[model samples]
Target chain A: MAAPPHFTGSLGYPPSSPSPRSHLHCLSPCNRAIKVSMSQNQSYWTCVTQKIEDQLKQLIPVRPPLLVYEPMHHLVFTARRTMAPALCVATCELVGGQQPISPNQALVVASALHLVQAALFTHEQLPLTDRPIPSNPETLTHHHAFAAGVELLTGDGILSFVYELLGRSDDPAGGNSERLLRVIIEIARAMGSEGMVDGQYRKMLCSVLGSEELCDVGWVDHVCEKKEGRLYACGAACGAILGGGSEEEIEKLRNYGLYVGKIHGLMLYYHNNRTGGEEKGFTDLVERCTSLALKELEGFNQGMVQTLSSLVRASFWDKC
Target chain B: MAAPPHFTGSLGYPPSSPSPRSHLHCLSPCNRAIKVSMSQNQSYWTCVTQKIEDQLKQLIPVRPPLLVYEPMHHLVFTARRTMAPALCVATCELVGGQQPISPNQALVVASALHLVQAALFTHEQLPLTDRPIPSNPETLTHHHAFAAGVELLTGDGILSFVYELLGRSDDPAGGNSERLLRVIIEIARAMGSEGMVDGQYRKMLCSVLGSEELCDVGWVDHVCEKKEGRLYACGAACGAILGGGSEEEIEKLRNYGLYVGKIHGLMLYYHNNRTGGEEKGFTDLVERCTSLALKELEGFNQGMVQTLSSLVRASFWDKC
Candidate 1:
């Protein structure tokens, strides 16, 4: 099959919000933070995303095995904004030590992370039943049994691809295979059962158990750590691992990732709840996570970490 | 969750066959060949399977994260017979060089391959429609939405776990990381889009497109090469690569794997067709793959490759 015509080189963001919420609702409180952040450092994030997309375009195959590769290429290259890849790149720069991994390798890992998130996004949005109408029309079409199958398998394929890329070069970045292997294992562990998948399973249970139980703030926080926080944190941690950060530095960056991840999750939760007139300790939780994230970076060079600090500040606080 | 009482160490194989055909149908002409081979080397194949299972039981986790880990453990540890892992171990021994890869490391890689196959098997059998009554009641239950989610994510999680295991050791088998990295890449490439997933996508399309079109022998053959052949080829190829096999030995084992894999796929295809009164060049195809596989092993010591030769001969020619 010939490649799709619209599959041009330019990074045109798809016209859809990837969040689980499906509403024509007004700007979420989270978006208000984004609006302010964008106004202040719109160009910065734009350049970051643009660079990632350019690298991604070069990385993915543009031709056949269109069924598998196209889904992944479109998912990664066409997305408007992706925090995971951005966080990875930013953290890489923050922790750039005596000998850092190449920017190309960093982008390759980031892009793979993005593909995992995209796969989960697609899987989650698949219609629970093979019905005529789906809740989210944009994410998946229930018209074919194979569409879900492709998405599911493609997701599995990309997960394997992440390792394939990691093990791509010999003595990559002049680092031994053992170090790279450690990095690969670390990332996989974070994304595996105890991390992202666990959180997802918990959330699924909460939804089935219904709203009365969903309001258990502790459970929400727990899920937040797993579902959103772990991946975000993982993105930054991967960057640190590849950047040749010292053990202390890696730990610091990981803590920073965990806090920032929590902030992101809380903001998303706040936004979803705001529309439903549900409120909790949203601001308090956000404040705590933001402060914790900031504290982790205090010992590091402020100049190199500014973009990440700014990104987190803009994601949570009204002012940077 | 408490471990199931049936989680005994014994290798009482699951009652179900891994084939797509759901009906209680007799085997096609393929088993006539199996009957002859099994009759001759019945004790040999049984011992190989038993040894693999003993190692598998020790390899899998026996405790918590029951939802995620249990599915994987059960799938891998319980299956009666699998060609992937068997081919891996067999090929490793066949290519025993001066300083062969340690048996522990070979088992590690073999187990990972088994996990990938099990994951794919689980995902393929998942209900396409989330209705109460599925075509195959044995595979999945129609309970919580989380059930499918868990199965899908568990499949994905195991895929990650495969890589995680590869990178688990610091100096695996006293071999440098470079060789292990190569083995990991080879396996990933075989399982990725171009290999297993590609064939799976084709089969899904055929099912969705159901007609005489599904019987288009060329497309079916192409799918067979991908879905079944690559993984088996990958398994043996990985063994040869890791065992310090020379280039010629590696190529021979790979060809042997491809042929055996095709023979296996053909058997399943033939069995699935018998109830439908459909037939193709089943006997001819089996004869050709079997002969080609045996030819690849011709140069090796007769005693060294007896199990493999017997496997091929039994799988096709009837008498060992």
Candidate 2:
């Protein structure tokens, strides 16, 4: 549908004085301006908006409707185009260089990205396995969804860039393409159950809720190994894949991943250690984990080292 | 004083049934076992305990004194130590590491870390630059104090680590140190006036209270630059100081800072959009600024990246 021209700034007169009763006429400036613009463009409108407005007027009868029903439809329509420019740009981007995608198609892609990002983030923020479990599923779910969405957007953006590279015929089997694929897979796996999300949930539940007698250390370790640990492995695998890394390089990347995971875990533990007594141990733990992670990253091949280092350099841990 | 010997194994008692009547007396077997152990340990206690117990007893009297304070003090002292081993460890660590560290050092550190972490997380969770200026000075003071404390701890930790590097002859050149100093000063400046805090306060007074016209676009830009943009810069600066990075490397880091700052701002905007419509945007603008400041560490290094990434990974943004 064609959009109406914006008439917001075409005021008929200057603003009136602040005193009440100074300008009963001033209140209708917008309507008057709109009427004047409409009159000037009447012939053009008759050929276009006149029919549409007539149809709309007919559809929306003069009779009073259910108050609830009226607002609901109006709200939905208003919300659908609330951020018109951004959504329009997003839609165009989604449909670019490919088949035209429906609005729903774009929305689905957006939603999937959201979910993936949420899961990754939720897992990362969870405390160490030694702590208590979180009480609320909603909070967990909310975090998971948010992280997943962000990851999806980031991955999608990267993927789009990859597609562009492919389109440009830039080294069909180049290391960059492989690295991009690996990043995608790494992100996907991390979004999976055998990654950060599950590990964090398990740790939180065990520490917060599990009875001391009932809790099993092995179970907690298993969760970390399978979930959190595996995500690190996946990330390293991706790095190796992308960089065309040797076995030694791969191993170094893997070690880096493990170090990062441990640091991540320790940070969570540090956060959870709000009781004054636990601060020293947690801080020490954070230091050890960070140092270990740095050392491991340092051991990687120059390219892999550079990549990992850059990523870390772009993060907050180095600051502290 | 030495810890009392701990009893182990069976107490030579039948399994007691859950009965309210005998609950208090159910420890008879345990008491008897303790007595037996005490008799066995009499020799071990004679030399050590005689001196210690004499001192302890001397602090008390054979009969109750008029004050009745010594016994209560001793009881509390003994009980607190016995009940909380973690507390003891913290106290020892704090005292041992002391260069005139406070008596409640552990509490201070723990509380400060938690508050800062929460502030950071909350800021990230909400939309950017959307926090309203605090209506009262008290709230402002509280936020400032918390932020200052966090900055102190984080900066101190980084400086101490750098000092260690210096001790090991791994220090960067004087030029690098000078750059670090400049970065720190810049961060302080950004956090002070011409920063997010001021921008937010101005926004609050203008919007919520209707004290002025909509904030000047320049003011908004300045606020964003300081609140969101500069925080990432601070994080990057800290990272560069820690990791041996050139000026060019630090410049590259600015992209990450910018990306995170924008995202942080957007997130806060989104949150405020959902919660309070346009008016809340003013409040959220301020809040977002503060949040950015808090999250400086989160975007600065790998460990923090992992922590924040994990959190976002778990959230609802994925669904959106």
The top-ranked prediction according to lDDT is: 1
Which runs in model 1 stand beyond 4 Å of their true positions?
Answer: A1-45, A77-81, A97-101, A130-146, A169-175, A275-280, A316-320, B1-48, B77-81, B97-101, B130-146, B170-175, B275-280, B316-320
TM-score of each: 0.79, 0.25
User: Which pairs of residues collide in model 1?
Assistant: none
- Candidate 2 achieves a global lDDT of 0.32
CAPRI quality band, candidate 1: acceptable
Candidate 2 B-chain TM-score? 0.34
Give the C-alpha miss distance for residue B216 in model 2, angstroms: 52
lDDT, candidate 2, B113-133, per-residue tens? 222222222222222123344
Q: Mind giving the per-residue lDDT tens digits that candidate 1 earns over A189-261?
A: 7777788877767766665555655646667788778867887787888777776778888788888887777
Candidate that would win on TM-score: 1
